[model samples]
Target: MCWCGIAVSQILAVRVDLWNNGNLVQDIFLGEIKVPVKVLRNDSFQAWYLLQPRENGNKSSKTDDLGSLRLNICYTEDCVLPSEYYTSLRNLLLKSSDVQPVSASAAYILSEVCRDKYDAVLPLVRLFLHHHKLVPFVAAVAELDLKDTQEANTIFRGNSLATRCVDEMMKIVGKHYLKVTLKPVIDEICESPKPCEIDPIKLREGDNVEINMENLRYYVDKVFREIVRSSISCPTLMCDVFYSLRHLAAKRFPNDPHVQYSAVSSFVFLRFFAVAVVSPHTFHLRPHHPDAQTSRTLTLISKAIQTLGSWGSLTKSKLSSFKETFMCEFFKTFQEEKFTESVKKFLDDVSSTESKEPSGVSEPVHLKEGEMYKRAQGRTRIGKKNFKKRWFCLTSREFTYHKQQDKEPIFTIPIKNILAVEKLDESSFNKKNMFQVLHGEKPLYIQANNCVEASEWIEALCRVTRCNQKRLSFYHPSAFLNGNWLCCKATTESTEGCARCTADVPADTQIEIDGDRETERIYSLFTINRSKLQKLEEACGSIAVYQGPRKEPDDYSNFTIEDSVATFHTLQQIIDIVEKLNESHEKYQKKRSSSAKYGSEENPIVGKVS
Candidate 1:
């Protein structure tokens, strides 16, 4: 679908056409755009151009006023660097689980730095989830977040890192669960469009409010039935995550047992299922975005689900969350206890990981794939000789790569046999941005075009294999060169690694996690944004000093700091640690430069030491 190697003078064009399924003129030419390529020195070009009418004299005149399409386009190109370049940053993030105060964690700091917290949250959640550190990490961060909140009703309300992580996790694991629960109903509603808008004032001409309410009731009933009945189909991973949240919430508020149910309901019902009801296209329940009327119908049904779910969380008989009068009256037709029991049963089924095996297997998911060069691994040779570009794919089940038109994989490594995936020493193959996958004593080396892809591949590979029982305690960070390991001085090829493994996942056949290294990663982030930290400290002081009536347009107003007193204390701890760490960082840098010229943090997460 992508075209390259075009001459500078060549033209780039886009022609829009209209297609009707059963019309006489099924295909009609609309407009065309022909632009001469320019600015060849730059990587991309972006601009809005006017659409010209069809050039042919054979065009019909019936569609003269079809209206123009509105679109905004942006073109960009990125040249990803070799993995060695980002080694310092990647290694820092791998240590995120260990950061104290949680806010100083690399993941949190990344969210702070980005314009949208969701952007940083997605990648960080995926990275940690793959490494078996998601639960503990999320617990620690959310615990700190809870401490900063004074309102019980609004707990975990914002799109904070913890909430966003859970959101992304559900999306990652619940693809099948969503399809099974909502696709059929969604397809029916979308295909057989209905006029279900119930607001009397907003109803269209000739629209009957009574008939619309009946239609609304029918759709809502169908969606609610699908949701409450399909609890068994809920994904195991999501259930596990929800179970963790339930326990965490109950422990936090032992006085109220309803908090336990509401915790799971807040996410499952409000965020996950109800949101899907409103936007089916986002969850892939629908192939295309719905029309305006369909969207309104979905929205009304979505609100009804939310209302019932919220009511299910409370013990009160009164249903009071409805914003519209008609909706309030309409919901009266249904019995509250009937749906409440259904909600309770669904929550119980999802949270129990007892009968069936937990759906924790992230297999068959396309973890990562791109075109990368692989060094020839042969029994006849002791070291690599040449590299060739091949399409590589790593999944939970296996790692495979193939050439174009290859029906089967040319090379594959079973996920179980993967012992250590570490950065390859540049000296071993005389090439930059290289990594090796160790299955047996003989490692398979691969080269990447740049540092980003190299880090991504290593992160993804390490994530899937974190739970493997046979992982190595120590691994050669580098490769064999001149009959000795490049990482260590040992001359024997079979000698153990000279450096200790840095990843938190254990090789001890037990699930062990290190949550302290995350702080070390945060120390680096603090260094990067030292000035911003200072400003935040000043804002904390200002908010503490003044407790007057509300004011806006100030440094303190820029943030959503819930418990300012608690946040101030946490910020002081972070600044103190950051300052102390920077002192040690300075001394370490001087020693490395003066005593050891070869040693560098540029090596991947594990295998290299300073």
Candidate 2:
């Protein structure tokens, strides 16, 4: 499965290094195998490459015989076409909001066809979210999942489409929230390792049992404090999703008092924060894997967090399910009520309406940041000034630029105030690679080092604010210079813009997903997994036709298909769409091949993913 995330060209190289029992590790270059990043780009490329001396090797001779190493590289790039290509599929998905029983929707049907519900859920969530239809679909599916629930404890416990969607949603929106909340302490614990093992059997000889318990207590307390204190930092979108889950869970299990807490905690704590604590590298909290000692320490902390997350279950020492008496006893030492109160409050904050700006949060998401020259907004019309090089930073909340990197920003523009961001006419600024940001009354003019940077900055600005309500409907393409709006030639600075804005995307939109790109990826998945989809189609037909006692399910039983008729109908439509898409792809491929020149070079990333 592929995710829309960052990718960099990196070729693995093996170098000689000393591994002294995981201690005193240093660069001891021995041999190397270099594979071009291009090879992995087209598809997974596996081959045996001979190791040779490093090009910069000063300590080795060419006569050195480095052994051969077998490399298996698996990677893929989805070449998404234009938005028009995906319109039909997008229309069907847009109607997901109105899909009765919700299970009949295109998005939900996609999940039923895939093995890992996540593969379908991730893109579906993003697509529905972009079109502002996620909450309804999630709520509908969750209600379906809740129908089979006999106990409050199991609410959202299953790896259903609804659950997976929520998981991906949190991971998408709460990425920055997690970093702000847990990364600091996670890094502290990793950089400074301390034994938190309270298990007597696991403790090494000469280790102070009391000291270990105290260390464990210290870490748990620190982590808990951060979790509770950072509640306001939760993303608004996550809050909405959690709020829906809590509301639905509570509604379904009206008699169960703690179901609401469990509904939110099941993901926020047990899944999100605690999981990140145990595996910091996976969450990008740390640069690399922690050492053995640090890893052990993190595991202990993660365990404590998970138990504490279940505030109600923590009341029963026996039900806490501690494997060892020491751990159970150590948990007794915890201020159980305080931790419980913290968890309760944190859940409340997250499920409630998030504040405008997260309080006490210094590190907002650094979206796209670099150094650029910004021309001063000179008060006098006649005075000329040179552009001042400044470090500009954009986050979800605001855009600010500083006199120096890592210093106080000289200017700040709240995301709401950004009316428009567009390229400035070269004639007005008399410079290439110039753009302007329309805010309150004045415009901020900036010059990038080059054209690509200029386009990137503009795209990022518009991308982040595309959904902003306050974004102007129109704007002056040229800068407002010498007391005139250059593009409109309007006398008043605040006159209505002469040109309409390109994007009216909601100002409150939290995530920016490429609808066409996600649609293309889903189409590709269907093309590759056509056989599995056909099997599902037949299974849906079988189940709908055979209204008898549920017999043994075939291959499609692996997927959750609650409504066979609805699923079958959706599957038929999807098959039709996929077939059409496949035909288009084939035609495009044929056209390209027909136009190919003799001995012409194609993609250098040789071979498809294997």
Candidate 3:
């Protein structure tokens, strides 16, 4: 048999002939076969073939099967097809499991057509679910289109099929793709309907916005549960999900105290903090993993901490209570001693930093209530024979000493009762770092690491305790007294050092206060101006915008020009401040006038004003 190929601009035809044993017993001319220029479905053309009897002298009417032909036409390039045809092809592929693998191009076309059609995407996804092993289906669901991920997450976040596919994909493709694609869509669907305002003052408006608190609660709980479920099974995805959820919560409900409270409460309820405290290894770096994965997870954990930390500010005492609670629960469940120690250390460190202070300040200026600062190692006199090394911690409230890093303080000195700190006989102990903390009933002789540290400690302590009553009228001038230096500058050289050299305690220590008053003044002004501007913008419903010179021209003259644009709101802010100041003055004048007219109410016998 002979076959001939004919080509045209748009179509190619393959003409076939049939032969029996090469005798040309029958010449069968097949119908014209058009080579597909583009394909809408998996098949390029319909399958068509025929067998015929020889036209020789025998002339038997019964046809003999010589040959049959089948063809599959598909498109590599983009080709539009009806959704029905793509659906049909997908169904056929799913039904024909034993047949050749599903056509990649057909799946691609189906996804491309159904990318935007939610109605069509779900059914396609379901079809792919049955044939996910096929590259075409996998690509359609995960790689080729995002609509599948969105639809799956939106419509069926908890659906078994979709979640299973996602779990598998996360393992196969890693957490990055899930974060960039799937997690956002899920978060969008689960986002709180109430529009969150960045400023707390603006959040007052959201109270009237009508939100379903139950829905918000359910959303947070659901996301938290999913992350917890994946803690062991899908650690990488769990890390990403946790970070994403915390970020969304913090960013969206930054100013909403109730929402922030709810988030913290939810984390506690769901045992999220418990998991974190116990299995930080899962969230943070794994030394055995590659650098990239380690870095990614480490960054994610850090961000998660930051986001959670922003949810609410906890005081040092409250944080200690939380640490105690977490440790209690953590030990109850895991009971790993090593992890317990590490977690306690971590908690101590984090809890110690409960308050965030401004950088570059040498002293803890903004000390929170019960916040410990300036903790260091020092030697305390135990008896005349020995000095014990101890860790000293200073707080606005008290001074404490601890035997170990993670232990509770064994000694405490209240700041309110401490009267004064005096420089001791630095030369007597073969050291220049001795100081005495004079408080109730006795003076405690403490040896610091160096002279500078001793000076700083004494200055800090004196500044905090200068208002207290003097505890001791005079130094005792003795060698030993209740594990303290009773000797006032008494040394071996001098039999009575107190008599030989009188202690000249300064009226004020060398420590300076009211530091950088100019900077503070400028900051206060800026703060006041900012508040006034915000008020003006709120009243006027317009924010001032500054338009600078165009950067494209790069004109040298623009740099020298003094120009700025301000709105009516700018003038309005100044007017508002002036009005407030004037109102204060008027009120002050009215108060004086009333007081003068009323004479002296406190003293009823006083004469009336003339």
Q: Which candidate leads the pack in lDDT?
A: 2
Candidate 2 regions off by >4 Å? 1-34, 38-69, 74-79, 129-132, 317-321, 354-513, 542-562, 598-610
Per-residue CA lDDT of candidate 3, range 1-610, in tens?
4544333332433323332234332223333333333332323245554443332356555443444544443323121222432343334334322322221232222222221333233443334332333233432232222233332212223323223333333333233322332243233432323232122333354353124223333333333333322221222222222333333344454554334233223332223333332233232311111122222222323223322332232333424454334222222322234322333232222222122121223454422222222212233333334456666777656777777555798878877667556666644454456776656544566777776677667655643443343433344433343344445533432232252212222222121222223122222232344544343333223222333333343322211111112223233433444344445545755765567554354212222111
Mark the regions of model 3 whose C-alpha exceeds 4 Å error after superposition: 1-385, 471-473, 476-610
Model 1, stretches more than 4 Å misplaced? 1-88, 311-318, 356-610
The candidate scoring highest on TM-score is: 2
- In candidate 1, what are the lDDT values of residues 259-378, reduced to their tens digit? 777778878889999999888967878754466688778988988887777635333344455567787777887787888877877777666544321123333656678888887764
lDDT of 1 at 449: 86
Could you give the candidate ranking by TM-score, starting with the highest?
2, 1, 3
Per-residue lDDT tens digits of candidate 2, residues 1-610? 1111122323342222111232322223344545555455544455766656544547556533765656444446566666887888888887875777677778777776676777888788888777667777878888888888898877777888778888887777667778878998888898787877677767798899899989989999999888877755565456767888899898998888889999999999888888889878677787555666787788888888888888486777444677766768888887767778778877877776433332334567667899998888754242336578999999868999999999998889988677788778887768889888988756898999998898778766865554345656678877666778778789887788787555332223246789888899889778777887788777777787556555576646576677788777887888898888888877866775678653456322334554
Q: What lDDT would each prediction earn against the true structure? A: 0.65, 0.73, 0.36
Indicate whether candidate 1 or candidate 3 has the larger TM-score.
Answer: 1
Compute the lDDT for candidate 3: 0.36
Candidate that beats the other on TM-score, 1 or 2, i.e. the better one:
2
Q: How big is the positional error of residue 439 in model 2, measured in Å on the Cα after superposition?
A: 14
